[model samples]
Target chain A: MAHLDVSNVTKRYGDTVAVNDVSFSAKPGRILGLLGPNGAGKTSTIRMITYIAVPDAGTVRYDGRTVGPWSQQRMGYLPEESGLYKRLRVKEQLVYLGTLKGLSEAKAAERADYWLDRFGATDWADLKTEELSKGMQQKVQFIATLLHDPSLLIFDEPFSGLDPINAELLRDIILELRREDRTILFASHRMEQVEQLCDDICLMANGEVVLDGALRDVKQRFGKNTLILEFDGPDTFIDELAGTGRVRVNTRSAHRAELTLADGADARSVLDLALDRTDELYRYERVEPPLNEIFVDTVGEAEARRMQHESVTGTA
Target chain B: MNMSLRKIWLIVRSEYWRRVRSKAFILATLLVPFGFVLVAAAPAALGYLAEQNSSKTVAVVDQTGGQLADSLAAVSDDQLTFRPVSHPTDSVRAAVRAGTYDGYLLLPDSLLTGKGHATYYGMQGGGLTDQIQIEGRVSEVVRQQRLRAANATKGVLSILQSDVSVQNRTIQEVGTGADHTFAYTAIGYVMAFVIYFAVFVYGQYVMQGVIEEKSSRVVEIIVSSVRPFELLMGKVLGIGAMGLTQMVVWAAVVMGVLAGAAPLLALFLDPASLGVPADASSTAVAEAAGLSIPPVPYALLGWFILFFVGGFLLYASLFAAVGSAVEQQQDAQNLLLPVMTPLILPILFLAFVLESPDATTSVVLSLVPFFSPILMMLRAAITSVPVWQMLTALGLLAITFVTMIGLAGRIYRVGILSYGKTPSLREIARWATYR
Candidate 1:
């Protein structure tokens, strides 16, 4: 297992910065979630770490050594838009990828059969990849990533097309790898999965890292301003609280609503208002904002700022 | 950039095996040789069939008093049997019309002078060969009669009838030898065509392989473990090996068929029937009968392989770049023209090169990197190319392919990961400038 450190990395395509001064690290025994909206540079950052694309500036290091082909041998990356050779059989595809990662042919075949059996896809081994369903293809890709037993694992949207059962299976394997103390970087837009799996989280927006740290600590930093209310009456008081500019209603319905308390707003007052309007108050709790809200708040602010800057520059 | 040779080998092995095992590859590999066998054997088979159907018997009516019919009947061959009929002309015509004879020839007396036309009456139109045979026999008989009447000496007649044959031989600094110009030209043209076809076909295979990886989005995963250049080289080398395998199979099949078929063909064909001059030596008759198969130029074949490898790598790399820059096959059409132009230029100039392989223009064109594989091979086959020119052409080709591979690697590195509209040539050029 190795520590992956990407420092001050920037990647530009044409005039646009795809990954700008992005810095993060993942140590052994931890799952680092690379969270971002679409086009928020998560894939770009992962690519740099894997050495698929060279950064315009700064460095990507593994165990304090600059990453190169040697690092690549020890890193397994499952790209966001990964695919297999459509004409190649599943076992063949896995073996090719494993051998490319420096596994001997026999060992690759052995590992491939092992993984195929583990995924309960032994029957699909001789079938061409195109013959498999999208979910099955995803499972095969996951196996290919793990076949070489690399120290560092990077999976971008690994569970996107997988059914719940397969997703659960993948999650279990990832957790198992983490127990084995391998460094894992999981990049996805699914905040719930990230929250459930990641030990450390690095959130990016507008090609820059906006929030990053230990997941629990990052959530703690967001503070306990989010209120979750379950009630059984008219939700008019939720709208009334929003009108007062004391809270932001994230979602509202007649029976339940989630709201973020505005700065300097008292959670108790919001609860009292909700209690007064509802015929029955079932449950109420103040908690730190979920990663989903944090994602939106940080990326939404970054997008707004970019638009503002673009408008200003357009006029100038 | 560190490149893992092992990874590249793995890629090459996979690419080669994947295609070589495909039904399409097997069908194509086998079909080419089958088609070639069909083309090569069809005419010979037809000619043999026609020869079998050409036997005819003609009745001769002699009114010349010079006994021309007797002379013709005495020299009758199997294909044309002549019978001297003492019957009247009308009777002979009736006999021919009644199918007793294929035709009847009438020799009328005209004071022993060659002033009258001999009339042949047949049931149907005669074949050209039959007509020529009958006319030649009649003319020889009449000429002999005239020569006797004129009292010409036997030596003079022999001198007048002697056949002249000119053998073509090339005197070169290497050695003076009989020139198999026909065979060499044919083989040279075939080699050039094979290279042209292989380069275009295998180069596109490289392109298609690249595009498949890119469009399927598998390239990024592969590139993460292997450098882009190594990946590209692996693909090119792999596909090129497939092409070589197909060509070698074709060559072997064709050679095997020829080796097995030559004696069989000779059995079915008659040397005399092939129109070799009468009284010619047996060896000359055998040569004219095409029984002496020319030895294959293995050295030239060696050169052909060298140029093919160099040319394929050069064009396959460029094709891979084009494949990387496009998202679909249709988008590739526009970019293909530039790469295809150089390949086609050599073919367009093939006629000029073959017509005068020693011409300065041919020499200069053959030395050009893009044209050398084809034009140089043509020159080498048709004439003895000077050692310096061959070396220089090969050197230029080697340097060009290596440089092309490097440049193509740069473009491919960027283009494979990019998705959207197909980039303009200028934009692709800009990508090569990326760090």
Candidate 2:
């Protein structure tokens, strides 16, 4: 059974439909990347799932039951923005959030200590949140999101404002939580991180889901009809592939080029064409498209269409 | 939709404990009333001390066979003393110049003939106590002399003397008032202002609490756990608890100061200065008249708490709503002004209400939801307020309190997550009714 099932949830603010007919479910112990643009209804959908908002015309269920204290207690949410009391001590803030999520004060404090130490933020435990640097406060907020030992965690752009070292630390911690079978759902614009960490993905554009499935399945759905050529000689052979009716040269440099084959075309033909002209062909290979490319490919056309509509309506 | 008891309790506990532990709450609660008392007592104490430091000796040249000089001596208290001098005004003036006498007075020959024949002179001026004493004693002496000459003093015992002391009875009240002007004014005004100040001052804490949560963006996480309505209720009730605690502390401190200091201060103040007679005849007359002390307006204090709490919650709800709607304290200030406008309007007509507490307009204003919390208690203090009026004001306040919380809850739920800038009045009104 799904740990969280948000079905046909719709929300509106004024005349703006923040989320329309949004439906998704996350299996237990699997990470689902909720992908979206800035105004793509990710936060609104997350809010509805957590019961911060009730759906205008849908239902949200957790563990086969409706969202309630039972679900809210087991769920953790780290909003993209900093959500902390500036004047409150880091340890106390963590403990307060923990207790609110249903831990006892003693348990919350104990977990806060362990997390603070794990994050190498023990020195900041006694300091006020405002006294800490932005990165340090982010780490503290991250710790608060974990202090209750929640079964499910929703992180909205959690890696934002994090330094590289801290981000690496967070990446490792997320992997560990995943190993421990915690259901994780994160929304972010960072495609590389999302592609690397997410087992499943749901991409949103303009308050509606455009693509969603298992990460591998979604990638497969887009198909990887492409080839990579690495050589020392001029890559002008890629220009010939561009001339061919069945292939298009995606890029060409001094020693390398990438080519995408049209439907009913073959990567072997593109690779053969590249090798025939190259005096020193180091390598020729076929490869799947990166998630970023797929994301841009799918979302780009949607964006272009939106622009066209906006132009026609003069609403831009 | 799920507002569990534990969640609300947790929110309330946090809000309450955070403020109650602050040093500002402690200092303001314990010291403000003492400061007010110091302001009220400083001048009277300075005058008493000034009189104590300067003792006056006035010499009188009695042209009426020393009768007026002896009369002045008979009435002199410790503040001023009189000495009969066998000399003219010039000699007395010379003594004043020598600093042996602080001042002098002369009694003319026609002093006993109902003509104003007594004149006072001093190097500095007439003393505070000396002038009244001398005039009183001289008039008594002249009247005594006239009665002796007319042989009309022997039959005075046969005259029937009666005194009527007006005992103020309230038509439908538990307490009575003695003619004590001090107690009436003290109780009424003190209760009125205390409630008025707490409703605004503590109400600010509620507003600031909302602004703090909103500005810091912490409310988003909070609302995710507890409903915003629950969060708002917890906050308002928490601040209300703190306000009540501060009020209790202040009341205790004020009551203690009044208890321990009143007797000590009474030593320095003159009963006669307060318009009550100090002599035995006046005492006998008062006893004969049976003048009762006014009932302490203290009983009406329970009513004061009722209005104060009702008024507090009402104003506090609005303040919290404004706090949530505004992104900054400066914006909250603009909103606070209009919210406080209704309170200011009544103060303009406060004098009339105080003068005639039972007046039609005063009674009507006292029942007006916003004004009643302050104005009603003030009016009730001066005169007996009808039970029905008190009930009506209390009833209106209760309804307004519920309505305000409902309205503020709507605004708070919708506005807590809003950011970037202050919402306009129309925007706030929309939030207040947002479903």
Candidate 3:
């Protein structure tokens, strides 16, 4: 059974559809990346998933059953904007929040100590939350969110406002939680982080999911079949490549000329022709498209197609 | 139900401990009693010290064979030291210039028998005792001269003798004024006043508690786990416990002060030193006058606790709810008037209710839960309270108390999470009825 599933979820903030017709499911032991830029309904979708805001149309289910009051006890949500009582001691606040999540007092205390220690906040445990740095406070909030060991975790911009060291630490902790078979959904605009961490991805824009699939498959579908070659060749070979139906030279470097392959073209033929011309070629490489290139190309092409359609109808 | 109990208990425990251990709670509990002591003790001490610091000396210049001089001495107590001078006003004026006496009284020729005579004095105002003593002496002298002149009415002096005393006894519906110790009423009033202040002062603390939580955005975190009802109740109970603790300490201090007052007052103003017996009377004139000290204190205090707790809870719950409804401390003032009106109305009614506890209008006001606490306490101190009436009022007050908690909780639940919108009455009413 899926660890978490949000199906046909629709939420409207009084005529503003915040999350429209959203649906997804996540299995245990895998990270599902909810990827969207700012104002792309990421937070709204996460909120609906956590039951902070109820869906107007559909259901969010955990382990094949619909999410209800009981599911709230089993889900951990870290909101986009997190806050804690500044005057409270770090340990006390964590323990209080842990207990609020239905942990027994002893259990809450034990978990608080363990998590605070893990986050390197043991010394700051005695200090007031406000006295700590923002990164430190974020650590405390993260601990509070996960102290009860919920099966499903939703984090909105979890790596925001962190030094590299702390960000790496959070990354490691998230991976560790994934290893423990916890289903995770994180929303971020950082494509590199999502590419590195997520097995499944959902991209949203304008309150609707634009593209979502297994991260590998989606990248393959949007992959640009282009080869970046560095060779001591001349501009006449670029003309020869362009003569072959769909191959075009995109740029000329000081040491090389790069060719972009269009439909029904093989990179090896272009490479062979380049080699035939210059056996003194210093480097030859075929680079699979990076996730950033794929994301920009996919979103850019979609926007261009939308604009073209709008212009023909004289609406753009 | 279990979850609700668990959540409420969690909230209560946190609130209870947080407030109980707070420095403000500790200070308020310890400081207010000494404050009451100062208010009760300062005046009497000042009065006694003023009396001790000044002694009046009146010089009598009796130009009529020393008759007026001897009469002046007869009326003089230790407070008024009288001296007889042999010379006329000129010699007395010279003595007055020397500061030997505060002033002097002169007896002119043919002073007795209501004849034309005038006595001149210098200082004006604030010499009532001095003036009265001098006048009494002249009257005595004149009476003797009249008795000597008219021997036909020897029995006429008996008819002229009159002494007035008014006896006060306290009584009530269930207990007589004499049976109830005035000390009990004092104790009750002192406690009742503490409750009154606690509700007003600490109830504001509860309000500020909600406002703080709301402004801090902590209420969102709190209400997500524990319902706002739990939070509100927790705050009210926690603050109420703190208040009760403070009141207990204040009560102890007040009791100690009141216990010490009698000995201290007796030491400063010994009855024997004044040469006046407090209970001495030649006749039972005070009894015949039918005046008595009413058992006003205890009854008023009893009513005070009832109305005070009931009214305090009613109003404080609303205060807490209102506090949650607004996000800023400045905005809290908008909702304060309704709560404040009830609190201040009792203060205005205090004199009228205490004066006429059994008056129909006063009784009606006392039956009102808002006014009953202060008014009933005042009435209890002054007159008898009907048992059935007191119970009925308390019952109605208790009902109001429960209803307020429920009503306030509704506003709290919605308002705790609401931000930037100052909810109108209609919205709050909707919230109240929503769940």
The top-ranked prediction according to DockQ is: 1
Q: lDDT tens string, model 2, B1-435?
A: 243777788888888887888888888877897886666556656767877876778888888777667766776767777888988788789989999888887778777666757788877766555566667666666766656656775566234123333333223344353444446766677777777778888888899999999888888888777788878888988999888888888777866765555555655654444444444233333222222223455568688878888888899888988888887778777777778997677677677887777778888888999999878888877777889989998999899889888888888888887776787888878765444
Provide the global lDDT of candidate 3 against the true structure. 0.71
lDDT tens per residue, model 2, A1-316: 2488888888887778999998888877788999866678988898887788777788898888889767778888898785689878899888888878878899999999999989888998889888988888888888887888888889988887688898999989888888888888988767777889999999888899888999999878877766777887666667666666776655667887776677788767666776687788888776686665566567885664453354345331
lDDT of each: 0.86, 0.77, 0.71
* Index of the highest-lDDT prediction: 1
Q: Give the deviation of candidate 1 from the true structure as CA RMSD.
A: 6.9
* CAPRI quality of model 1: medium
Q: Please list all clashing residue pairs in model 2, or write none if there are none.
A: B176-B295, B177-B294, B177-B295, B178-B293, B178-B294, B178-B295
DockQ of each: 0.62, 0.43, 0.18
> In candidate 2, which residue ranges exceed 4 Å CA deviation?
A120-125, A226-284, A301-316, B1-3, B44-186, B261-298, B432-435
Give the higher-lDDT candidate: 1 or 3.
1
Question: What's the TM for model 3?
Answer: 0.66
User: What ordering of candidates by lDDT runs from best to worst?
Assistant: 1, 2, 3
Clashing pairs in 1: none
Worst window of 10 by summed lDDT in candidate 2 chain A: A307-316
Better of 2 and 3 by TM-score: 2
